[model samples]
Target: MRITRGLADIVIDSLCRGVFAGDCRRLSLRSCFPFLYDAECSKRSVVLGMVAGGDKTPHPDSPLIQRSKKEKWSQWSLRGGMQTLSEALESYIKDKGVEIHKDTPVEALERRADGRWQIKLPDGSVTADHMISAVPAAEMSRLLTPIAKPMASTLREMSASTVAVVNLEYDGEVLPVSGFGHLIPSFEDRAMLGIVYDSLAFPEHNRRSSSSTRLTVMLGGAWFESSVGDPDAVSKETLLSLASEAAATQLGVKEKPRRAIVTLNKSCIPQYTLGHWKRIDHLFSYIHQHSLPLSLIGASYQGVSVNDCIYNAKKAVQRLTGS
Candidate 1:
């Protein structure tokens, strides 16, 4: 927090607001806090795509919390899809005799007279000694409000942003330049936030013998309010039109995409704005004071990456089992 308030603030205050002066200063701040300053100069949506965290999210509380010089900068992509990571974990957990109920929406969470927790689903209720909620904060608040009004009210104040992902497949190679892809700064005023060069990043993405290209365009975060109409109501064609136009102009793609898929993630990533630490501190303090056998984890608290979720889950299990 001191580094962000002292060093980062000093560097940012010297620069003009919402202006891209040079790569050196911007990169320097990014080196310290990747998503914070960029969103300040541009749109929050741009960096929201990079880190699951939002624009005003406190830099000190961000994924960059680990500032060790020994930290490495290596990233790996799954051959199938990011979902494979969860699938693999599920398989391993199932083998360990964990019973997982899929597609069951939790309707309510109530403390029973016997001192157990009742998890009410549409079909029935299951009582447990402890519960770990991985759902979004909003959903968690909704489930817990009946039992914990004050805590639920505070959790509701935590806001989340929605993002729409448009996956486009061209008949042949369409990217003008090579590499992973490009992220547009909000100041640039592009409809699309960024483009991930899927085929370029991983050739196996194309799969077919044909040298086709796959581009994933991310749209609608904080920009959704200004750019796209309500994401849920926005038509697939409308999203594609905006994304394709940006691609053609920026990437020099003349051919229309052979395939276009749209995925609207609603209330997906939580925004960790200024003073976020206080809210988190209060949330945990209440849980401890109440002796609530409930542990909340996932993108809402720590981070939004697959690894982040797994790390938090492991810590929660250790806390609950006392192992």
Candidate 2:
């Protein structure tokens, strides 16, 4: 089978004509990832292209996709925060007699003569019968380099995008919209990639304050470094300022934020890029050839989202147990 190359190579007529009725040049379908228009669904990994970036997929130009019986649709969220899910999982695992190590970063991985895997940590090392890495491909490459240099090299070539999040609490409803939020198009040339109407999306978010609206403004993605500078180097204050300004302008609100929380997430989202499948195929081939007891999972290789990770984890566990 022939692999479709870059975003430019794919045609965009079928997918987004309604949004961009005429002169599609004004809007690039390549700007959106996993564009539903493609005809070859299998070629384009069933991935969340929006969060990662559009140019990441191998087949950006597949013809429009029809609603499939196989597709499941549901949006799930925890009451407190997304972190609540992790905390609950940690607690549940602990209750189930699983040893949960907190804050211990894995430094390296080595294979022992007995065929067991040794994991190097900050203070010492621990041996495990099997190992599964949920870390980003680049970080995994660093750990895998000692064991499989070629695989590590290929993994390192994988790219990821960083995001700076600015959380702001306003005195009142500052946004014109009353729903989840809005994603800005790249053609807008805006610093903010998207904005989430937290309070509106979830009423619980507003209970903390007296009818105040909370907005999570996300900036920096594929265009971050080019538009703003190094994501890590950019100060919280700067991000807050940019977010506030963008929010105010976009929402047409005059109320200044009562408070702001800025977070610079380095290498946050993986970029699928044009020919990502080839790299993945190579990495998997190496792992299978060596019969490595390592299973790669998470946003880097498969899908991105809490549910996606959970689904992938379950699949991995089944594969490992041969159930």
CA lDDT, every model vs. true structure: 0.70, 0.69
Please report the candidate that would top TM-score against the real structure: 2
Give the 10-residue window scoring lowest on summed lDDT in candidate 1: 16-25
Q: Which stretches of candidate 1 lie over 4 Å from their true place?
A: 1-73
Candidate 1 structure quality by residue, lDDT tens digits, 97-166: 9888889999888899876899988889888998888898889889988899888988887776667788
Clash list (residue pairs), candidate 1: 57-272
TM-score of each: 0.77, 0.78
What shift in Å separates residue 150 of candidate 2 from its native position after superposition? 1.6
Error of 1 at 80 (Å): 2.1
Give the lDDT of residue 298 in candidate 1.
83
